[model samples]
Target: MRVNFTIEGPPVGKARPRVTRKVTYTPKKTSQYEDLVRYTAINSFDGCFDHDEPVDVRIVAYFPIPKSWSKKRRQLCLINKELPIKRPDIDNVSKIIMDGMNPKMKRNKQLHRMVEVMRGIYHDDKQVTTLVVKKRYAERPRVEVRIKRDMGD
Candidate 1:
């Protein structure tokens, strides 16, 4: 089975977990982005992805050209002559999206509430046998995600 979806707006990288003497938690920005990814994935298709199958994931993150860049540079980026080589590294972007789609269960600690139960794309990120990630520039910034079962050779 294969699933495909796009998360609109600027792509966000996974932020490092904050640690205090008392407890550790995900940053608000990271948490919010993850929620968006999860919500989009859950609603993208009619059926849930299988749990035990090996999968391959590919992500392409598109960034908007900076206003400070000259017209020539902006044109280059738009045509793929130049790429996004700044912050929000590719690895971080991929990590957040994978975590967002994986099934999760946690107990104890903060008393807010547990994450809502939903059919997830896969059992865990570890089940991903292949991953491909890329970053580019676009007129409308967004992240495109593709997940598919891996049929081994």
Candidate 2:
């Protein structure tokens, strides 16, 4: 089976967990990005990969051309003459998306209980055996993800 979805926004990387005196927490940026991904995934698919099934994923992160750059430079970036080699490393970006597609639980401070943040697309990110990630520049920023069951040959 195969699933494809596009997230319309700036692509985000997974930030290292932040540690306070009492708790370790995901950064706000990362959490918010994950939430966006989760919302999109839920709306995009009706089923998910099984626990033992191997999965393959492809992600393409598109960044908007900087306004500070000259028009010519922006055109070059849009045409793939220049790549988005800046912040939010490819690995980090991949990690965020994978994690977002996997189930997550969080403590509900007000309710004093654990609540499901998302009913993910898979049991775990570990099910993914192959991942292809790339970054490019586009007129509008977005992230495109394609996922499929891997039938081992």
lDDT of all the models against the reference?
0.87, 0.91
Error of 1 at 67 (Å): 1.5
Window of ten residues with lowest summed lDDT in model 2: 114-123
> Cα lDDT for residue 26, model 2?
89
- TM-score for each candidate, following the candidate numbering: 0.89, 0.90
Query: Largest lDDT belongs to which candidate?
Result: 2
Residue 69 lDDT, candidate 2, scale 0-100: 98
Q: Which candidate gets the maximum TM-score versus the true structure?
A: 2
Model 1, CA-based lDDT: 0.87
The digit string of per-residue lDDT tens for model 1 on 1-153 reads 789999999999999999999999999999888888888997886665566778989999999889999999999999899998898989999999999887555653576666636556776788999899999999899999999888876
Error of 2 at 6 (Å): 1.0
Off by over 4 Å in 2: 107-117
